[model samples]
Target chain A: MEVLRLQQQLIELTNSLFQEGFLDDQFTQLQMLQDANNPDFIQEVVTLFAEDSERILAELTKTLETEPIDFKRIDAYVHQFKGSSSSIGAQRVKAVCVDFRAYAETENREGCCQALQQIKQEFFLIKSKLEALLQLEQQILAAGGSLPVME
Target chain B: MENVDGDESQPGREETGNLQNLLCGKKILVVDDNRVNRIVAAGALKKYGAHVECADSGKAAIAKLEPPHTFDACFMDIQMPEMDGFEATCNIRKLEEIAKESGKIWHVPILAMTADVIQATYDECVWCKMDGYVSQPIEEEQLYKAVSQVLSRT
Candidate 1:
């Protein structure tokens, strides 16, 4: 009785994510890349984005106090962070980088500091959403079902 | 001039001024849960000669309306707590319909501002059919162009 309800719930969660724009076609593509061959591929990648972005943010923070605001160093970090966020289809974080670079170009230390805060706020949001999606994947598996195809 | 605060290169003030021309005289709304972004964004928009307003989240945005109250365009930051941009966008569409009046009541363009920019990001923008987008840390020209492009057709 409950199993049917559970399946329906999983479907609903997937759809909700779609409507929310939390999961886009690329995320669907990520889901598609998985099969019995690699059940955890999407989840693994999501975790990696979560991890890598944290390190870049940390690196950027360490350099914030440099005199004249060494923008070369700062842009390098934003560039790297942009790449990682891009890889996982984290649209928001990468977008933040576009503005972040402008802040660096202007040597706006305060702007850069503020940008860092925005980046952190958005980075963790993607992390949690992907984590939730991964949990849903687990639920589908536990329910004696295959991964849901994102249409 | 009245609104700018944290920008460096006071000498580059001219450069910033050229950048501001992108949104010249435009009416804009900056939606973000963060106050700092609100301040920075409003300042940027004002530099471009834009009239700007700020809202913390989707809910606050929905509740905000001063008569003759309409922006030529809106910049919405996704991932806000309480009510995120996607839901807010959808809801704003509804509100616009209810608040509709003559003299260009058809559409109000909303430019999505986000820190994440990926294929997923593009897909979401498409899915939402947003009028425009400017990624976070927000470039002066890019932000202005996105707003201008959306506003021009309207």
Candidate 2:
């Protein structure tokens, strides 16, 4: 009963990851780095994502607030965020990065902030979706089932 | 939706060949994390009469590939949680030997899809050796072109 419920949840999470693109190669490699020795790999990686995202957001905010907006600095910051998000397959955030980068390129401070806010929203969405996925995985294991199979 | 670009888009269907039967005999694998995305892709390809399978992540996609697999091509999303398109594509490429040994008609093609459609993004696509790519906000005609270009097996 619980197992079946968990299975459904697991599938939902998996689908969200696909829709959002947070399960790409870089994320997978991070997953592969996990084992019984370090079972908290996924959690650790998520924490990193959260922490890193916060830092990037902070920097983006600072740059946007500058009277004479530093577009180059903003571009660099966006570029960094873009790479990290790209590696993890954070589709929504990565998509936002494109806009932010363009705005930075043009030194459109307000546009950069707008893109930042959007990325922030997407970040939370992906985070929640991933938490749901992780919870389902734990439940599946608790139910004595193998992880949900994709495909 | 036959390329419904609000009457401002280009041709809906390609005139090169009968795309309906183009992939009739081809087997395709859709590797994406989202079920909706996978279903959308499969549903679209099914209209063209091709057999379809789906993987929720890169990890899942790799596990499904075997000598017995008869995929003419794969439509892989760039980002997935378990394994990414790049890794999955590499894995599929490595399976070429086994695919040949199994007497399959042709080697598989891998196409990358993403919402990340920028100039740099395209360069990355080429870097990944993606046979083809389709941008996000995916339309029917764009999808058809991608599938047709990759599935030119018939």
Best by DockQ: 2
DockQ of every model listed?
Answer: 0.02, 0.03
> How big is the positional error of residue B14 in model 1, measured in Å on the Cα after superposition?
53
Q: Work out the iRMS of candidate 1.
A: 16.2
| Candidate 2 lDDT, B98-152, residue by residue in tens | 6777676444677786745553265676666668876542445666777677665
Which regions in candidate 2 have their CA more than 4 angstroms from the true location? A20-38, B1-154
Q: CA lDDT, every prediction?
A: 0.66, 0.67
> Model 2: share of native contacts present?
0.00
Regions of model 1 farther than 4 Å from truth: A66-68, B1-154
The Cα error of candidate 2 at residue A9, in Å, is 1.3
Docking class of 2: incorrect
Poorest stretch of ten by lDDT in candidate 1 chain A: A23-32
> Tens digits of per-residue lDDT for model 2 on A88-148?
5566677788888888888776787789889889888887877777777887898798766
Please provide, for model 1 over B1-154, each residue's C-alpha lDDT reduced to its tens digit, 9 standing for 90 to 100. Answer: 0111223312255545655555677677888765534544565466457788888888877666322466777888876667878778777776666657644454567788776555227667666656778865455546545755766554
Question: Distance (Å) between predicted and true CA of A52, model 1?
Answer: 0.7
